[model samples]
Target: MPIYGSASVAESGPQATVRVPATSANLGPGFDSLGLALDLYDEVTAEATSGTAVTVEVEGEGEGTVPTDERHLVAATMIRTFAHLDLAPPGLKLKCRNRIPHARGLGSSSAAIVAGIMLADALAGAGLTRTEKLALADAIEGHPDNVAPCLLGGFTIAYSTEDGAKAVRLDPSPRIHPWVYIPQVKGLTSVARAALPERVPHADAVFNLSRSALLVAAVSRQPSRLFEATEDRLHQSYRAEGMPESTRLLHDLRTAGIAAAISGAGPTVLALAVDDAELPEAPEGFEARRLDFGSGAEQVATSRRE
Candidate 1:
């Protein structure tokens, strides 16, 4: 669990402030519809001053594997954020500590995209509303499910239409618990997405539509008809092909009477279980974590020179 702290420094001033939570999407049949904000986090600190270089420092996840230069995810997105607003790069220094695992079904890249954009807006003194932030986030992430919950918190139902995106925030009550089972390997979002077929049959579409509605109803009102509401016949099937462990976990969980769904385009499964279930809270058997559904994203200042 990573927590991003406040910022205090002397230079140009506070550039931007943002802390985004990791998200689990498509819980059951809520494809591109439902998403939950988790407690794991990634914090970003960005500052703009009079200088010529763009410097980035990363701690945690990609410490040695990633470049600490302009090529970094945060810096690259930061540049895009400011440039989109017609602001020149003012010698930025970015520091990020990542706690969320990368390349997993979790929204790691989405968090970075969001944190960078929000940080840039805050630092440049640019004005943008939460709705505007959602729009930008939707554009960068290419989907609204993950970004919606990360920006708005709780459980969200978001989708892209001809008019852009239509999103709504649902009450992420504490009644239901999320039981996660992460396999030993990380799954790629691109690969999971690519596995989807060009078109689905009408029967499958109708089946998913009904199940998606049931899933939303269950999330909106707990003590839900657990087993029935958490079933899917769409994306998860093909998506699971690339990560067989996810499909296996779902089967095993059902056999144990626990309803489960692929957490986003996942290698991880978000099972419907009581917080006090027989499963351990740690990574012992299948590496799991019990997550609360009510927590959302927050904005906070993170750093500057000492």
Candidate 2:
């Protein structure tokens, strides 16, 4: 069965509960293309109700801060998805349990968008094909890297086509282990992106291209080549000023022979290890944790009105 299948509906109104994993994009050289799903997750339960009113409740990561009405990201995306499918919007009550940290280069926004799309499809039994769902999500998120892994799981390479955004997933080698260093300070993707140069040297472009290809091989089969494969001449150095601490941490880890890179836009760092590698002490404001590769977004449960 597909990962995000329709929910089981009975005599009562339809409801769905979905779990989406956190994702890290641009794993070094494959900027705006590569992504990996992490074991961390955010779960959302959405129920269709009688009236047009929309209500939302959030716990864990984004508790009191995010919007509680239709303006919430998940609710808003659901409304958009219904319109995309040419279906009337339904009254909704959403309960979000978020674990992925917001603005921490951990694909939190992509997770919310995917959750909304999945919930709408399940509740309405829209029967959207996987490609249709991916296109819709990539359109909304403005990129496929994070959303691809959040939806398809494992390792993903996202690219745009004439139709829309598309991706392919690959299982990472068993020897590859992931460790994340999350800083207390959150980063704005906008700020990090703004730091990049509009153009890079042709030689630099060649540098990243070769490593990007090698990165696929290293992540898929040759875990030993990860250190070399993860090297990049694009993006990271340009973004260093905005995330000095993350840059420093990445350097330290790589210096110690671990394959380290700034996760997404940064302030967080991801280290790919092939053994029981000893990690350095977390910086003053960072927390270090090990995470396994995640599967895909899943419809975990369903509810019916009694």
Candidate 3:
């Protein structure tokens, strides 16, 4: 995946700061195609060096589990970006401040990828169009649903084409407040996906199509219509075998008239409510909170030129 663009020179010196938002994918019937960016963030500050070596320091999330050397995802992506631009790889001292939880249905990985790409973008003086960035990040993430929102913010509907991943974004209604219920245990996306059937009934397909179309409306204006719009006959039910608690919680919330769905391929449940609408209590062993939509990545600053 290669993007065509150029960046501004680092007149302020050889450092860049990048920020990307966490993303929630598959808001019910949309499956691997719909997603939204959340307020949570992962930030990276990188300073250029003379050699090709890379060093990373992590704070907050993934402090101990993530790599600190060149193998670090962000570092690797930065290296790839430099190579793609035909620029000599720069050594980097990267500081990552992560707030998004890892492997928990949020787009933590996508955040890192975007951070690296944007780090290179800011350093190269502003390379890569948003479309090109989405393609590169989607290729790394294996889908566009999460990456689209992580790059463009707001609500995104994404699809893959022969050329690459493409997406359209809509500003979600401010009236739409999202409440997420996160279970104590982590659920692997790979495991959840493995639980899905290779095929589904044609009726199921139509069921999803109608509701997914309705979802666009519900997310924007018809808040009361979300219950019907968010209903699905797709992967969620089958994924229950891998994450029964999340499935049960989704059902319980929906039963109470909340428009709920599995967040991404996992054990996190997202409930849609109108602004300030009183939400039900989360079951034991789960944490619930209201999260707002987020804007996309930006270069906050560069080191002041000496």
Candidate 3 residue pairs in backbone clash: 7-125, 7-126, 8-125, 8-126
- Please give the distance, in angstroms, between residue 116's alpha carbon in candidate 3 and its true position after superposition: 1.2
lDDT of 3: 0.84
State each model's C-alpha RMSD to the native: 5.1, 3.6, 3.4
Count clashes in each candidate, considering only residues at least 3 apart in sequence or on different chains.
3, 0, 4
Which scores greater on TM-score, model 1 or model 3? 3
TM-scores of the candidates are 0.88, 0.95, 0.92
Model 3: CA > 4 A from native: 1-13, 304-306
Instruction: Note the Cα lDDT for every prediction shown.
Output: 0.74, 0.90, 0.84
lDDT leader: 2
lDDT by residue for model 2 (1-306), tens: 211222323235678899999999989999999999999999999988766789999999989999999999999999999888777777788999999999999999999999999998888788787788889999999889999999999999999999999999999998889999999999998998889889999999999999999999999999999999999899999989888889989998998988999899887999998978777878789999899999889999976687
- Report the lDDT of model 2 for residue 94: 95
Q: Which stretches of candidate 1 lie over 4 Å from their true place?
A: 1-15, 280-285, 302-306
lDDT per residue (tens digit) for residues 82-176 in model 1: 67777666667788888777776778887887787788777665776777777777777788888888887777889877756667888854667
Q: Which candidate number has the best TM-score?
A: 2
Q: Compared with the true structure, what per-residue lDDT tens digits does model 3 show for residues 48-119?
A: 765556889999989999999999999898878777667766667899999987877888888998898889
